[model samples]
Every structure is written in C-alpha cells, then in structure tokens.
Target: MANTNWAGNIEYFPTDFHQPSSTEEVQDLVSRATSVKVIGTRHSFNHIGSPTEVFISSRNLSRVVSIDRIEGSVWVQAGITYGELSLVLDSEGLALKNMASLPHISVGGAIATATHGSGFQNQCLSSQALALKFVLADGSLLEVDKHADPELFQACVVHLGAIGALVEVKLALVPRFEIAQSVFLNVKFESAVNQLMEILSLGYSVSLFTQWKGDCLDQIWVKRLPSEPSPDRFLNGIGASKAQQKVHPILDVDPVNCTDQLDIPGPSFDRLPHFKFDFTPSHGEELQSEYLIPQPYAQDALRALHAHQSAFDKHLLISEIRTIAADSALMSPFCAVDAMGIHFTWKKDWHSVKAILPLVESVLSQYQPKPHWGKLWAMKPKQVAQSYPGLSEFKKTIQKYDPNKKFQNPFLKELFED
Candidate 1:
C-alpha cells in the first residue's frame, strides 16, 4: 500500500521510507541517499516532507529526553506530538506558552513549518524553540541555539525540512495554569471587522468563525486565564450572545471532539487548543488554505474575502480568523510584525476550490498575504517569496547547509528555483 499524507491529498512512492529509532540510523540514511527528506507525522498537506526518492520517518524517535525545571525548558525527540508533549509537561507542572488548534501534529513538523496558535501576544510555536539537534547532509549531528547563532538559528527553525533531519528540539516552558473557554454567537460581520482587534483582545487566545454567506458571523471563541473575568454576553453591543450549548467551529457539526467550553475552567493544555488531543481536528474531511496578512490590513483583507463570498460560499465549510504576535523566524508568516490569519476550511472539492484560490489571492494581493507553508495554495513561488522579507537570506542559508542538495525535493526545488 502507498503512504499518504494526513489529508490524503498527496501520495508518496519513495525509494525507501525508513523509520529510524536513533539519530545514527537517520544519519546513515541521509549519508547513503542521493536525495532525502524527513517525514514527521505526515501532517503537511503539500509535498514538503515527501522526498521523491529517499526519506526518513521520525515516528520511532518519540522520546522526552529531559526537562530542565530550573531553566524552564523541555527537550524532546523531534517526532513527539504536541499532545504527547503537553501531557508530559503537565504531569510535571509545566506547559508550553501556546499550541496550535490541533495538537496531533509533531513538534518538529509544526516548528519547521511555522505553525502558530491564536493570541495577540503569543508567537508561533517555533518562537519557543531554544535549541535543536538536527542531522546535517554529511550525516553529522549539529546543535544550534538562539543565543549562539541568531541569524542561522532564525533561518533554521523554520527550515521546511530542506536543510537537515531534525532529531531533537528544546522548547521554553511556563508554569502550568488554568484556562476557561467560552463561545459567543451571532456577531455582525461589519461590527466584528470594525472592532477586530478589540474582539481579539477580549481573551488570552481568541478565534472568530464564520461561513461568509450571511450578514453576521457565526461564532467567536474566547479562551482566557482563570483569573480573567468571563464575559457573560460578549460583543453585546454587536448583537452577540453566549452560546446555550457546546458549538463547533463549523456550524452544526458534532462538538463532542472539541475541548471544554461554556466558561468552564480546565488545564491550560486542554483549553488553549480548540480540539481534544485524541479527537480528529476540523471536519476530518476538508481542505484548508490560510493566508497570514499584515495586522494593519486585516480589515482590508476581510473585506476582500467578503467580496468573493458568492464564489466560496457553496464550497466552504467555514473560515477562521486568528492572530499571532511577531516572531523572528525568517520564513514565518509573522516574521516582521504581528499577523492576522484568514483561514478557509472547504468541503473536499479541490477542483472548484483551486479555481477560486487565484481570485482569493488577487483580492488580498494588495496586502501581500503570506500563504501557510504547509497548506494548499495556488500563489506563484515568486509571489509567495515576495511576502517574506528574509527569503534571500534564507536561500543562502539553505545553500550553506545542504550544498550537495541531498535534502532538496521537487517542492523545494520549484519553491527556491521559481
């Protein structure tokens, strides 16, 4: 049987798909192969992690190396999932600063692709990275820290699995805390956009959801610290009311898999992410595309998406608006400053969706939206690179690390060449 990605959008036919339990085995594979890539959890929707010929999977490398309580950091194998890491951390009375909506993704995969969680102050998951151990093209293990090599580290953290195979990652940690999640309903789209920042600032982490076919938004999820006062009726002036029962991000779907809501307090790990650790995130059968635009142009981008409502309304299940603070990773969508992500979750129909992406791109073109590296997109490579200010430096760094191009896959070749 052929191996496929989590979304089943891409299938792999590699010369070998080796599962290496130790870094030495991974190095051996890299040293012997003409071309190779590192596949972690296979969460990526694109071909970034699937090398055409040879590739190594880190699934067997799942282990928690150590936790430095004094330094407030946790080191774990690259294949460890955030869900698994969180449980380990929580048991020790520690936690990550933030996490992506779905915790099923591997730590290395999420960091390499710049996956982020929601919050005006919380940076992308990669920002918490203190140091990393990766196997270089020469089959040598190299470790880099933020302090010793700022420039290379900045470029390396989000390497897109192009430079090397990450073996271990060290991340900053925080004292465990409690969080409460609440959902508000029926907020007018105009009002939400007009006070978008205000709404986002309502809680520690916030997410706004809508279908784009109506005049008002469908729901707004506000996740907050236990000490923060819960809003019984959020956006009241804008006609938003507290949801009577549990609700899914996309309307009418089962909320059983979602995390606790209704302002009930729970462990930060269980509350920060939208979905539960064991449950399938999103609809389990959908295609996703997201664009992170400059925060200042959020209103403009929202207006642009709203303009094409008729085209996407039928094919779209829902759209989510989330925020992330500025980060230093070169290729990260929010590298320069804080960013607003406009994400679309569509009904699994790529034909219709692909046709509309260009129009969606055209509308938000003025704002220079940076497409998520791991999701689906139709933007030209040049257009995609234009949004990242440090693309040139990132390219140079890639050349330095993988000069033999052993890690270069067709996706990276087109991305860097085009």
Candidate 2:
C-alpha cells in the first residue's frame, strides 16, 4: 500500500472493520454491537481507543447525497475525503472556504476536531455544518442543526464521536475560486507578521508556512476570487517580487532547488498543506501539538516560542503560526474568539516531546490557549471545561443524546464523565 498520513504515526488496526452502506445499517449495527468506535481515515495520531468488539469504518458510506447550489449547501456521506469533496464541488462551481494542509483527511474526521486552514476570515471546518445526521445508539437517525435541536446541534458539531455516529454532513459552500501561491526566504519575523496581516486583509484566503531552523520566514498562498483578475494582472507587483511568490510547482523538485522560488500557480488545496515539498521527506518522524490562542496574544506567544528555541531546537521539526476568525461551534477551539494557532512538531523521540510539552503548555496557559481536541494535550477534563465558555451547556446536550456513553473512549470518558 502507498504510504499514508504526512505524520506516518498511526499503525493500530481493529480486530474487525465494519463498513455499513447506509445510515439505517449504521444505526442497526450500533444498536446491536456491544461496543464500537467510529473510524474515519485513521488519520489521527491517537488510537481510536476502541478496546471494543468492533470498529466502525465509514469509508463504504461515501456518497454525495444532495446539493443545493442556490442555498450553497451539500449533503454528503461522512466518509468522503476533502480532496474528493473539493473536486466534486469544483465541478459545480462551489467550494469550501478553507481546508487544512492535506486534502486526504475525511470530512467527519476534520470536523470532529475542528481542523482548519489559516485566514483571518476562515473558521474551523466544523463551523460550515448546516446540519448533521447521526445514528444514535438506539438505532434511530437524528438530524440536528441550529433550528432543529439547537443545544444538541451545538454540542455535537465537534462531538468527538461521543454523542453518536455521524452518518452524513450538510456543509455550507462558497463560489469556487483560484489560488496563487508564493514562497519568501530571509524575511524578518516581525515584518512577515505585518505582511501576513496585510495579505489576509485583502486576499480571499491566505497561509503562512515557516521552518524553525532556517532563515525561511514565509511560504504564502493566496486565493483570489475568479472575477478579480487574469494571471498577468494578478502577478504584476505581488508576483514579481522574489519575497512574494507561489509554492505548488516546486513541490516535487529537489529540496536544495526548492529554496526561495516564488510565484507558482496551483489549486487552493495543494498550497495549504505542509508536505508539499518532497525535499524534507525523511526529516524524521515527529509528534505534533497545537493550541489556539486569541489573536491579541499572538505576538507574545511567538516571542515566547522564540525564547525557547534553544531548548526547542533539540527535538523540534518546525513551529507554525496561523490565524482564523471566531465561530460559535460549541467544541471549536476558535469558538467565540479570533485566534492564532501555534503548532509544534517535535522530533520522534517521545521522551523529548513529553518533556517539552508541559513547558509549552505553561506558556500557552498564560495566554489562555484552547487545545485542539484531536491532538495531544496536557489539559485535564476540568481544564478543558474551564477553557470553553459553553462547556456546561454542551454537556447537558451530550447527556440527552448519549447518556449511556456508547461512543465514549478512554480519552473522551476521562474528559467527559457522566
């Protein structure tokens, strides 16, 4: 099989992989099974924590159930990958506002943890849900949204498979557009942030990619609405500068040749993810932890990270910084606050990563950072509850939907006790 996941960290396989073709079958299986955990692409770094008789794989359920262009919405089976969805939406002249680095992750998986792309105007993928259809433990189908079941809707948006098995998702869409990407080397850190803010203000969407060890300051990708301009016009000033160029075409080139080349054209999805350049392939395996802090604290947080670079360099891959606007999804990291995401990819040494995590957590805690639900975190359930303003209300909704804890894994159970 081809290599999977940019992280290459997941390896455990369940005793059995159950693939149900329809929501009714999913419901029936859940009701009859003694214990089960939904698996989506298995892209997560943590194990599914099944410790159960069976594991549910949504892969076979892949399908686009419905689309309403006028309403800018799509109803798709939970197993559909972002790449597939993007292509499908493109054919219909519709697109998601933002998508994370790799397009291969499943929609269900991405939303379960609120995966996001960088842009001040963008929100987590879960925030795009207009509605969700889930299979309850009792073999019933529940369609929840802001209007249908307000509380449950909010709680389940980023539910982490605790409430029920997500069968399908209804996502909001935007008109399809083209993206222009570029890479800039040796940019002063402070100046880069200013330029990033400026680009984010004017572009439809933007991303800033940086490496910790090098002088590389930014690899930017900006998506422009198709109605705006042609290649020649768009490339005039922004395109010519070596410091403000694109990224896609050079992805397959040699790492040495990959330096400082600017102004490339490619799809929006390709430009957003980090594994684009093949040069750093065996940079060695790594562990990642990311936290979303309010934008006002971004500068301070970056400075703190800089202060620890000497200690960090021993086992760090790169530290990434990105921004996003706030949304109200109950479990969303960016919920209710404009935020900046700071991510750390540590060298594969577990001991080193574990040792450094607490220190990083301390700095983030001072800024009141919110952990990404799917990634490794040091916070206890109480800390998690305290971090999200709507935790109490969300738990109330969770109780109504999954009182029996059928979907509860050890990680979730510890974080959310009945």
Among all candidates shown, the one with the greatest TM-score: 1
What are the lDDT figures for the candidates, one per model?
0.87, 0.68
Per-residue alpha-carbon lDDT of model 1 for 211-280, expressed as tens digits? 9976878899999997876665547767899887998897788999899999999998899988899885
For model 2, the local distance difference test gives: 0.68
In model 2, residue pairs whose N, Cα or C atoms come closer than 3 Å (at least 3 residues apart or on different chains), thus clashing, are: 101-273, 181-246, 182-245, 182-246, 183-245, 245-263, 246-263, 246-264
TM, every model:
0.97, 0.85
Give the clashing residue pairs of candidate 1, or none.
Answer: none
Model 2 per-residue lDDT at 170: 95
